[model samples]
Target: MAASVQGGRIGNLPAEANAFVGRQLELAEIAGLLGTERLVTLTGPGGVGKSRLALRAAHAAKAGLPGGAWLVELSELRDPDLLTNTVAQATRLTEQTLQPLLQAVCEHLAGAPVLLVLDTCEHVLDECARVVQELLANVPELRVLATSRQPLGVPGEHLLTVAPLPLGERDDAVSLFTARAAAAVPSFALTDANRADVAAVCARLDGIPLALELAAVRLRGFPLHRLLEGLDSRFDLLVSPARPRLARHQTLRTAIGWSHELCTPLERLLWARLSVFAGGWDVEAAEFVCHGGPLDAEEILALLASLTEKSIVTRDGDGAAVRYRMLDTVRSFGAEWLAGLGEVEAVRRRHRDYFRWIARQGEAEWLGPGQRMWAERLTAERANLRLAIEECLAAPEPETALELTGSLWFFWFACGFTEEGRGYLERALRRAPDGSGPEHTLAVWAHRLVTVVPEDLDAAESVSAAYVWLADERQLPVPALPLTGASLAVRGESARSAVLYGRVGQAPAADGGAEFFQLLTLALQAYLLASQAAFERCAAVAERLRTECAKRGELWMRGWGDFFVSLAGIGLGHSDEALLSAREALTAKWRVHDRLGAAAVADLLVAAQAARGEEELAARLLGISRRLWHAAGLPQLGRPDRTVFHREYERRLRASLGDARFAEVVREGWELGPDAAIALALGGVSDVSGP
Candidate 1:
């Protein structure tokens, strides 16, 4: 542990033995995750010493990594766009091009192991997630330990959520305070004399290490109780306490301010512009904010590099595709600076414009092969989109509001963000002008999203009226925006679905292709309804629609169609065929990591098990299904009517002779057409006349 506390040092953790305490469990966890997995995120609230703890862990494990551990701090960088270059600089990489930077990073640490520490990454978490995913994909044998407020939420991310330090009944906050206080003043020991005052200081600061450290520094100037009194206006009062370290470590605010001041003017400007971003931002957003006049994206990469060199802006992880963010405290500092910059309106305008383009791209691609890709992208960009919505609402920008909401519908539905979808609709509908393209477009989107998931119909009705006018007055073609081919299929009334599908199917695609998905959906609905009318060719049409959907890679619907095909198979009296189809549906759901979809498939799986007379197997699968449903916070399907699905189970159960028993089955539904039949059937002979 021998080291000097001078300005420049390798790994930069305090060399003193007494400086590190607790985190044995955390160390073991970091060790385990890094030993096996490439990326591990240590997440907790701000000022919890995630960075210090990560530095210490890296110092401890540095020898294990022959290439030496490097810490990249990201709290100061205002632009998420340059996150990757920041890491490259931290590793002392000399590459200019992104490809070279990545290659240099990989080559430098290749065979020779290194722990890349990505610290204070919550705000730039999306960029961090992308970079981590990329690095882990490309860089072999390298590991990343990231510290953030929440998870990075990337695939295969191991979250080591750091909790506030364990406190004794008397408050570990005071113990920590006293220990750190004793470091500055040797005789400063905790006794009953000043215990109450010191304890008050710790509690007021909420057990955060930075706050505690700042509080401990006040012993040089004020009494413990006076320090407690001064915490009311914490930022102004306690942000500049006396400290042993440089001015940066004196107060929490000053520490952050010091970090920010180290950045260049462009980095500082980008940082301040980013104060408007609530959660996370990307490079594209940084370009939009930092460009236009003199400061164009033409020079953003170099500017991003300079900021990263000073350790103000940090690369999130190891990747060419990077994002950046600022800490809340740092973001606050940027906000303070941004207020006087006089480009608030212009910057916000650019923010709105960039996302409008993004929304347009999303709207165009939703029914294409990149549906899930866009779903994940929208999820990642939600914070930026939210900022756009808030900014547009406060300004003279009704169109932005409409486009923002309309662009996000697919994400809101596919990802099960039902309440979020509704909230966006309410805002868009309120802000929408009497006559505008955005208004008409978003109203339909708002309407369709509401209908898709059996949500409140109030929004749906208003949007439906808007849709009527859009077609009659504007004569806008089908699939204009919100009322796209896929959304129309999902949320539209069957009659409306038919009409819209008919129009979109005939309209030419952008590249002179066909809207085959729309046609396929219409054919399925026609075939399903036509069977009720005893149409002779209904089944044939259904089979053809399935083939066409398969040919077109209707990935989203194929999963659903699996269950529908099972029904078709049952209707055709092929029980084995139905079971196979249902099983495939369950497997697809699992493969795609769709827990909700898996739960939906669970209903089908139960039917498959029951129909085959596997009563025990049915109960077991139902048990698993219930647990999965509960975990997903979803209510169950109401008791299904025992039709071709449950008849075989009932027949076998009822006629079974001696030593056999049947129990009543319970089910859940939000009260649909099938439930009435289920209720009546279950009412007879206690749900079964079984043995």
Candidate 2:
């Protein structure tokens, strides 16, 4: 049967490009088990179609899952510590707090009936078991379907061993081979002339799906008889006599090895070097990381295209967004070759350096028109970035870890990875040498900013003192000084914070300073002005910042400027203007995936609606704001000024709409998903009915 697609449901599960040949019994059994069990694992050797079957089951079961079926691909994730974060990211949970990620994931899943497919768990088996056990224990309604080479020994777990496809007449094995062969050679068919040869090839390869698919591709270059003859010689030469009972596994490996031998020398070398990358890579990354010695940078695109045609690399997306990735089975094969060739360390270092360059470039370009593009590109490369950091930490001198982590402060802060960023920064600092240079200092400040609990006044004071000392000793302006001021303001030291902001603005402009830092200073200054009840001055500063951002096509700081202007408008009793500015700020924040900023903007929206006598909408917005704040893990960012407005709005809303009515509407709004709540706030929807 062709791949199934349920109406009215779309998710992260990838679309199957080819027909799903068979496995009726297995699919039915899996469906039955899913109905009765919370944890079902499909265990099989590599290339035996475990992942394919799991995805098919997930797509078939998507309609019954209220929270949707999300597939978390774990083949690229090497660090056990990031398992929870990976799952949270796949499920679209934007964590903005320093709270344990697993706790946040559990909370997010507790409210819905979700079907989570954890694919390829063998690399991190123990951590996967622990996380799965914890999730099942805490989230009563969540069901986990895992694909691994072995079972994840959690309690109440069900294991289903996936065997090779049957090779009987008209069986799935023959059908799969036929379908793929037709795709490879469009004129090919299962006629009497080639029927026996096709069946023999499938049986020879033990009916392993990946092995059969590889053999089918060979049909384009060789006829059926020649292909079977080649496979016979390869299997005879490669299959070891010491492992007769492991025939299926050996068959798959033999097929991969045979395919490896057929490639040109350069193709084999490129495959091994590409193994260093953790996840998918674009053409430019491939050219930079894999080009050296015999391989020229100009030849990478054609090499990648050849690899894609041969099924060694799967190409995805289109145009400038195109990416190439090897399957887990194929990547493992290449990794082994990479190790045997003694180029693992060298290639891995090259990969690290390339990603480090990417980090520096992102930092330098973060305040310009490419801000959104950078945010997206970096988010997509998250797995590779983590791998790069891991490589640095493993190096003898580990100082580069500090630089890499510190440079990503904007990604960690404004792009919704605050918790992950803090963890990396803390790790880098621990491994850093004492008396280290500017990299260490930058990391210290970044860690402080990303991990700071809004209520931690002591930490805020230390951060302030460090910046002051650094600025005085260097006799240069510190661009991040305004951030320290903002931290103080969060702790209710508004008077001291105001002084710091003023000093930073009046300080001589540093040559070639980062525009992000400059705009951030202005945004905080305007926020302080609004908090101090200087509405007109606050509006002026915010407008100036917005105009500057517009000239550069920036979004992150522009969103903050819009938010401050809304606060000033509300303070000046311009309800309509405040409402419009709040919506505008929300649009920008959502575009950049700034969950914390969007949540804060939702609070302003509540006050604006209340001020305009939209009591029912205001009450609903209050409830929506509660959910947003909970997701952000910081209510009003723990700011006294923002909290006062929130509380007063709630009190007035409660009195205007009777207590019973207010409570009812608030509950209704609280039940909405993030997208629905944001839509209501932005006036895209009239009511919060569904996401």
- Each model's lDDT comes to 0.59, 0.79
For model 2, what is the alpha-carbon lDDT of residue 605? 91
**Tens-place lDDT digits, model 2, residues 284-364:** 999988999899999999988877645577678999878888755567678888899898888899999999999999988
Off by over 4 Å in 2: 1-264, 451-457, 464-485, 495-511, 613-636, 639-642, 652-677, 685-691
* Local error of candidate 2 at residue 677 (angstroms): 4.4
What is candidate 2's TM-score against the reference? 0.61
The numbered model that scores best in TM-score is 2
Tell me which residue pairs clash in candidate 2.
Answer: none
Worst 10 residues of 1 by lDDT: 682-691
Judged by whole-model lDDT over C-alpha atoms, candidate 1 comes out at 0.59
Clashes of 2: 0
List runs of model 1 lying over 4 Å from the truth: 1-22, 25-246, 302-322, 432-438, 455-545, 570-598, 609-691
List TM-scores for all candidates, in order.
0.57, 0.61
